[model samples]
Target: MKAVLIIVLIIFTSLSSGKKFRWCTLSDLEQRKCAELSKTLTAVLPVTSIDSFARISCIRAHNTYDCIDKIRVNKADAASLDAGDVYSAVKLYGLTVVAKEIYEQGNCVFAVAVAKRGTLDIQRLRGVRSCHNGARWTSGWNIPLGFLLARNDLSWDEAQPLSQVISEYFNASCIPGVGVAAPQLCALCQGQKSYVRDKNHFCETSSNEPFYDSDGAFRCLKDGVADVAFLDHLAIMEATESEQQEYELLCPDGTTAELSKYNTCNLGKGPGRGIITRHNFQKITNKFLTMIQRLFGRKGKERARFELFNSSSFGGKNLLFRDATQHLQLLEEQLEIAYVLGLDYVALLKGLGHEGSSLDNRVVRWCCISNAELRKCEEWALSVKSDPLVCVQGTSMVNCIEMIKSSEADAVSLDATHVYIAGKCGLVPVAAECYGQVCAPADEITEEMRNLHLKHKGLSPVYAIALAKKNAKQINIHNLRGRRSCHSHLYSPGGWLLLSRYTVGALENVTENCDVGSAYQNYFWKGCMPGADGNLCKVCIGDSEVEGARVSSRCAASHNEHYYGNMGALRCLVGNPSGRSFGDVAFLEHSNLLWNIENLKSSGWAKGYTAVDFELLCPDGTRAAVTEWAGCNLGPIPPSTVMTRPVTVTKIYDFLMKSQEFLGSKLDSEFHLFQSQKYGENDLLFKDATQYLVPATHMSYQEILGEPFFQLAESVFNCTPAAWNHVQQHPPVHITHSTELGSAVLIACNGGFIIFLGSSRVNALD
Candidate 1:
């Protein structure tokens, strides 16, 4: 009786202590395989005394994202994810890689471009028809595209969809899942195009798309529909002898080699699929994976009963894990997705789906502040039929910046001051407005000038001048204590920051905290400083009071205010169409000074005003003609930059460059991108004086602004505690979940199993 009681107690304790790991399944077949594995694990539990061995349970998820969500919320514990999905899970969802599937090629695969012998050279593939396994596929898309981008063979404007660039690069392609977004990419596809009975599967990411996976892509090349096929090294080896003999691997060096030379001639190498779970659950998940591999792996004691890696019995291919996976290998160290996947591969993946990299993938949402800019943006959207643009409205410039940061809007063109603020909030400049003859378009640029162009492109610095009517000689820079003023907007580099630092900071006994805004309000008697309240907004007039216009827009820091921007400030000083001037002095940018005067005269806003009527106030309290702004300005200000999330920098740059090519000049009678006079606004989307949009790619905000200007901005803004707090709050996205695993680790195959290793083993499951 005592022995039986002891045995019962031990059984009860084992049942209570056993942990049930819920494995997430993506499809019905995966669910079936997971259930079978669970039952097999349960059956073997009585024979194993390992307390850490978890009993498996199946949890069905809609897809990889759903699986990640489930694991994050603790509804599921683990799932096997592809390299791309693994990156998303780890970086975005904070999941950790516990183990990886090792195939004959170890834990990584080589991507190769395959073509019929002498069909085409790798470097000269610009206008050829191509075949790809699928969109975002590691071997077919990411690796090859990344390789081309690195080689400068392919140019990506960070502002547009990568698919657009690919579609334009290749004359035609059979890129699965991309036909809907870019139809030209699917021109070579051989799928059923009829929609009857749901038969339209053209360029779908399935068997329906004749050129879908590695096999399909290879078949595309074989059938002569595609000149080249992008796939993994294994795909070529899996091809028939005759097929392999006919196809040759295209090397990165613009040469070709036999199919067997994939190891030496390949686009790039990328990591294989891996199992992921919540960071805190990595240890238990690793142990559970280890237990399953020991039981049903290739050399498992119960291999005859069930195979862990094989899913053929369940009427599916790669159901729970890849069919080619030899065995589940536990990572000795918890490696980051970037380390597991090569840095380049990780970057490519990030560029595909990083924060602010438009989720829609079809249209870029340009944030427009005020009705006038929105009207112009809407017109711009209508004109660009090829690349659709969606106009999103914000009440103020700062609001637009916040919208972009939260990804509500994709991009916005900002002045130097706003650009600095955007940079602090993790935004980057994609393109900059070039306002003079110094800027040149893409076709006109030569190879030798490319480096210099890239560095100085869009960097046409403008003079920040304090403009006053020639008749108002009493309103000099030194004695403007009680004078009414007109400013471009609050925090504007040219219109506000420079003026404040040199005049307010130097003359006024303001505190070190740099409350320049308050000092400006106290110093100037009345002013039209958009975004400021009280006396600062007293002299401001809101948008031409149309029937339905918002009266609250009077003090808004956007085009909604009649007294906004360099042009608006000029308008305020010269007077509106009624010839009722509001201020004695105006602070604005000199690059647009003459242009704004011309626009105001043409638009009949300041009909009689000319550049001769305006004079720039010098630091020496003397006045100079508007054309002599070179020496009379407060300081040189950086040109306005198109700012976007760092990840979408290239995409934004690409979009702007393309847009400029299509609708940049005023000569495009249909619509002019730089002219906003017709919309009853000045510099709605870009400054009217902008000669062209230049690439600011690879240039940081500091580099774009130059040290002198950047330092001047910092001094005026005071690098406030709030800004430092924001930096601390939002560290670089990549380093947010970084773990300090004692030493650098790498994966290697040893004794027929793959394992992560440093100098010493950390958590070897075997």
Candidate 2:
């Protein structure tokens, strides 16, 4: 592995927890003392200190220089340490012997186990998200792997040392004379070991190289290259942006799942190792120093350090627990926080569903502002009463801060550069920026906020901030000096360029140091070519996601009744707005659903879908709301319909039925609204579908091709202009056919022409 020391130096933007105060949180006296001390402190840095001896130390976000100057028994002077060693040196100088930990914001599972079986079992976890940071792995990948392997009838002997386990799996899956089966795992390493694809899908070592190692382990979960992945603190704060989305916290035991029925057992515990503060100093301090000396003692201290950096060894636990008191108080903290969230046993059960939740039911509240800008933000925050965590955005810096102080919001999520800048000024940044979109800054500085001036005001359009649920993400601290950019060239996997969001973050803002959490960039105001400066985004371009939004138009249901389909049949299934317009791939798969113009563009279905498929189709000039009457006697009857089958193959009949019920209920309340004011209602074509669903016999697809509606199919095919459509249904009509075209009729015909090809018509064509 060539000591794969790819240092990815990322600025740590973790919060000290809402209850745990960060530096900017210093009281008046603390702040005054700290500022006075800063004059004496020369070297201060915000980073974790793990010595060759494995001693841990820390300083407040903005109190670095001053913290060093205060020089209490546990504090070290800033000037005494190197740029990187400042924190550790200060700790040593102050004689502080406390051991701290690096934890992720949210984790899927935290497994700690000896890999006797050797296999990194990813197979069992199909849909569940796993964390990337490995700190909690004992509860995450390891234990989960064990449970799965055990279930599959494998023991430590069979799974041992990853390599053997993967090979054994390959052999078992392969039949002697049969052709190779599609591998359940990623590509194979030499012999039986499983390997992962790099950013580019080219063949290479997986988790084989140090920097790339975390990726391979994560890839098992990320690209579905593997069933599960390993995560630790570094993976969270430091992984490239693209890696964030594939996972989230493991749902705790007895929690309900989004799908499925029946109660499931808890996968594991939901507790965390606390930063147990050491209230009793003298005794603990002496013991901690001794441990540090052992770390430096000539006998294999180097080996011990490896354990500290890598969560693969129990040796790592020593750094976390040695001098730190279990802070038994953390138990109270945990209980109280849970209470604040209003979590209950019943809610847990409902959340877990039948599968049993594998993740903690608790959610972490992550605020995006940097630590340096707390004072202004806090003052602003104190004034607001609504959401506690806020992603601040606006034309004026004062306004942004005022909102925070006025109880208008809590955290101000922002880019790393802005976040860091805020910390330098005095704010508590809970989580680093991951990825998400926002409107870009104006071309010129229309406001002080955009210009980077703290005290200025007056601005342009304020970008909208959309926050992900608190529990939905993970947080990590990065070490910028160590990055794997070098190996990306040799390890391109799947034809994708691999770059961390941090790397891209640095590139996007022209500001070299920055951080963030999660992934996605549509609402981003930074990172594009003409963005904040020069920061690049660590995202796979060309990929699209669907987002749904509220519109000015109200649901078309009459007076009081709620109609599920009235909001439109596809409402629940619709994704984010920027989602790629319906294309060939999604359309054929969901051929039965009704869609308007927006659905076609968003789903990428416009390329092949047709208006004839819609229950009611509208063109660009259609009205948003209308009332139509049927004039023809035959047309006065309820409309008819034909269904091929549920398009979602994986969904069971029950799920499909659920979807129908869900959509059908909206029929009255939601409707296809037209844009035009005055439109024809006297014609039979204007009649609303009276019957819920009229069925028709199934016939050869060719028979469908011969219907007069096929001519109108061109209009459906052109469904990209946000066309509106909504129609009631008729009774079910089923028809079976052999090799030839079968008989069918277009009911709900609105006197619309029916062009059926029977024997005589076919003979004429021949």
Candidate 3:
């Protein structure tokens, strides 16, 4: 029985589905034009088969309101409507606007007020007689009224209605469509008879009234009845075409546009009428958009046979679409129906005036280092009151920086290295973390002369140091070839960067094509280098695996990677399986070494390692005791810096300071805030070594890194590990045209030949 009913339903639906696309129309003339256009479309359209293609049919309605209702119920497919009507259709029926009508040179037109030159100014027109197109219309109502509400401090009471306020503001105004309930609103109407729908000759929405539409409102001003005419820019342009010297446009600032340039000389702008359809008919809307553009567009071939844009008989006004429209503009993804018709305009149409919703737009969105970083940021979010802060997480630091630029996230903490890259990519640094508590003020130590030594407690410079076994006498500091090595991570100051600089500079005849990771892998027999992906992770022996990810979380540069960071690298050297490949040397900071030696149980891999078991490798081809790190250190590395866009640098700096005062220290035991042990051997959001965050004295990357170090770092940054392969083979030259290989051309006057060697090289004429 179910199968039989399904077959019957399918057959019924298929039979009911007609071969014509129905478009809703408001008048009889539009229906006639629709029929004529449908017949002409067959010949004009370039479709392969006309019989299979849908034909155009018109569904007539009394007004736009009825047309929208019919379209919503699937009685008709589409209709063109003004922004005001479009807003109603979108709000009530969830309609999607496919395309908008383009007039003059813009997809939108502005509403303007016209008055006799030298007669009156806008500021003094409180008691002047005004002629409006109609109540609740774009040009006549929403535009002028919305602009006034936004700019002026109109002393209106909550008890008084919008119509009453408008009536009181303008002494005698012809605002058509105002009901009889608001008698003061319609007091300016010239018609003597009582309020009637279509019978009244004045202050009515239809053509029966003298000041109804754009033309009529301008006519009221032309005949010397109204002091000012409130209408669309197009209407004023059309009115002044024959009588150019009759009137002038009133500017917002009480000035006048003596010569008409509607683009610049207009009041408030609003989107024009757009073709709307129900949201459910997405496929139909797509097809209809293509067909309509082919039929009625500026370059449309069908428009040559039958004019779809213009209306001819039966009232001779705008029918299916406004006749004055030059072409149809397809809206992009960013623009929506509600957006096209602004919020203020929509509010006015719905009679809900804009009071305070437009104000109080302040939100500080913070970018997190990792998913785990969100926990602390959430706590911070609760603390902030004015300009509330919210947290958003990204996969990596790169992702966070990108999110900030795209407005997905507002700010993120960055290392000094990352600070340089972010600044190059159009981001600015907000504050720098000082090692000590005593900062020499933000401006006092901005220059290089000042030491900027805050002398704060519990903070000191982190130093890059090399570690090796106490009994390891087989490998010398200068000759580290074939010795298993461990690194903190790639690009880290104490690991890849510092080591790469020393090794590459010390090694003889080193070319640019040398892959640093491959070289490190080849240099070491077998060892752990955490956060190394692909070939770089060849020797990394991570114990734990990340849950359900294609990327081995063990090899990740993030906190998820088990064998990651300075401590992880140190553990790789000391805790390698007794018999198997154990790292002979480790590159890490001096502070992490002391911390791990003191608390062996903190890291899973640091079980059996002790301070007496390891020694530091100095550059002078000698190994020294671990306690002598001050003399054996490679270099002093700066602390991690916090950065943000220049727009909110000050706000972010203040927020950071406030947050640190409460939750940045170990005193907040509820959560070990900045301490790495809280997150299990991971410095997720901030470095665990950092005692506190302080304002950066130096601003630029060049300033932070002294002139000597800046020059060296810049040179190294310019050339990647494998840059030799990309080096220019010869001097580059401009080529007129691409030629085949081995092709040669003889010069016209000279006995020289220009030869094409390949795609890149060309032998020029001599």
Candidate 4:
């Protein structure tokens, strides 16, 4: 009975031991760090009723991969890994990233090529002798090779092994990982073959090889045995610290620069290392999160007791984390591993030598402004994540446009006013929203809209009109010098151009200082003209601001701003009280009037207001019904255009065209490509009245607004005629199915309707 009772007692103790959190340790250094960390954690954690603090036990493993396997099978709860190793654990073993390692430089490190000054130029790297850290590693291999493959300078056979292709491309190399696959891979390795000090080593991927780690690769170059050493920026920094005069970094732009400028002159970039754990240990991972932070974080309070990140105890580098890591960041639940590393890096790893998923390579990264728009974009991203769609958030449309120019984002849907700015920044219109019907076949075309191309419906050449109460006849067209007025924006054709020009000419104040824009600011006591000079925005209430400014003019520069665009001007007129920054009349597009008037209750302003309360102020000093805008409206304006960097027009066009085919008007889709429902605003992303999207071949600023109209806009915006002339002469080229690679096939839609279509739609064109 005593023997049986002792057996039961041993089983009970083992079951109780399971309550303790188990952390995987790969090396003696990691085991020692964990031992020190556990003691500190015991003191910090809350004690239980049994007087025992949160307990931690070490789980031993031979390598990081073994530790990941141990976690997967529940032998261990967690382990830290390099990004490349994290990718493997997440992809192959169902591991989850709990935290990311943020180094002093940041979460990302640049991969660069370093050589003796004047030894090699970036352009002719072909057949050059090379030194690489290892095969399939992020910084040393994937980044450098992916950069080469993208430029089409390095060609290889996908059917053959990756090692064979790499060997053939380089005249000689000391790449460390390939000795197992093929000995020729280490043909240039200078390590002693019989070094018995290390077992199963020499020209290997680990520290066993003399030319394996980043330091080893640089040593190859330092000894004058290799022409170029491809390694991470951190490695180069560490290796060349003592001998700075002999080495220089290579830039992708065919030049050599200082090693300190590696971020700007590198092959590519990759994410930092991270701590990975199995999904089942989420609770344990969460528990350890705070404990680990207190013990080893950048500002860890318990770091004095033990250095968790030290990687130099053994003759090798990299313990639980890279030695260079500054701290570990707790990752949010929604942040995916691939997303943290960036999709491009993951895609390269998916298929090193062969053509991987085209969808991966052709992801369309979009930029949006405002949290509301970002929410909508996130929804859109979910639908097209298979297309590898990604979204970047910006503060304003101007910021989005800048993102595209810097290659930080792929595209953004822009307003006509923004299109002009984007064009000046070297962007081209790919497709446009079509508002009017395509027009029945030639036989069915009507005489009133004979020209199908002129069927703008409610888009460009759109009439701009002044709306005011009928009783406001006291404000005649010619005698409104001191009247308060509302305008769409400072630079919009409808708000600033037509009305300002007419009012200035009427008042005979059209000189340089008293230009149309300034004259209106002086004439109107106070108006809600967005983007207008200072006091003009006194009546404005928008919160968003330009980069250096304190506050955004009350007019909306983006969806985030209130009363910013044509609709904003209408809101300014109807929402604000008259004479207190509100206006007796509003200068805006005719469509904004029609759209908002029908949905006033939805607009949250002018409740109980009706069309009978407003009338059009014609230039001829006569009042007319709002419906009579055709007769009373100002000069026509061009339709809104979708613009992108000239280099990416073709790719963006192809993706958009494909998207529309499945989610286009013909398909029954869950999401509307050109719709939003925030505050009952129908035209958030694209215009609500859109009919289709069309190509905009040979479209120019001058074409959108005829030369005379363009000149007027230039004057309003204070643009030089020479510069304006240049914008007109070189019309933006649109990429099309038939257009050659070097040329453009500009596509346009009417009324700013964002059409969801693709190359399939191109064939649908008559």
Predicted model with the maximum lDDT:
1
Which candidate gets the maximum TM-score versus the true structure? Answer: 1
Give me candidate 2's TM-score against the actual structure: 0.20
Q: lDDT by residue for model 3 over 237-352, one digit each (tens)?
A: 55545556868888766688853655566665555677788776645555555655565556665566666677765455566777777876665443444345432234344332
RMSD of 2: 28.6
Q: Candidates sorted by TM-score, descending order?
A: 1, 4, 3, 2
Off by over 4 Å in 2: 1-98, 101-121, 124-275, 278-661, 670-766
lDDT of 2 by residue, 177-198 (tens): 0112323222322122234321
TM-score of every model versus the real structure: 0.53, 0.20, 0.46, 0.48
The weakest ten consecutive residues by lDDT in model 2 span 488-497
Error of 3 at 285 (Å): 22
Tens-place lDDT digits, model 1, residues 55-161: 56788764466688999999999888757667777777888888777777666667889999888878888989999987777777777776676445777765567
**Cα-based lDDT for every prediction:** 0.70, 0.22, 0.58, 0.61
Off by over 4 Å in 4: 1-67, 133-137, 154-169, 172-205, 209-213, 223-225, 239-242, 296-305, 313-316, 342-766
Question: Which residues of candidate 3, in runs, are more than 4 Å off?
Answer: 1-366, 369-391, 436-460, 506-510, 513-522, 542-545, 549-551, 576-582, 602-604, 664-669, 724-766
Off by over 4 Å in 1: 1-362, 440-451, 454-459, 506-513, 544-549, 575-581, 598-602, 606-608, 664-668, 718-766
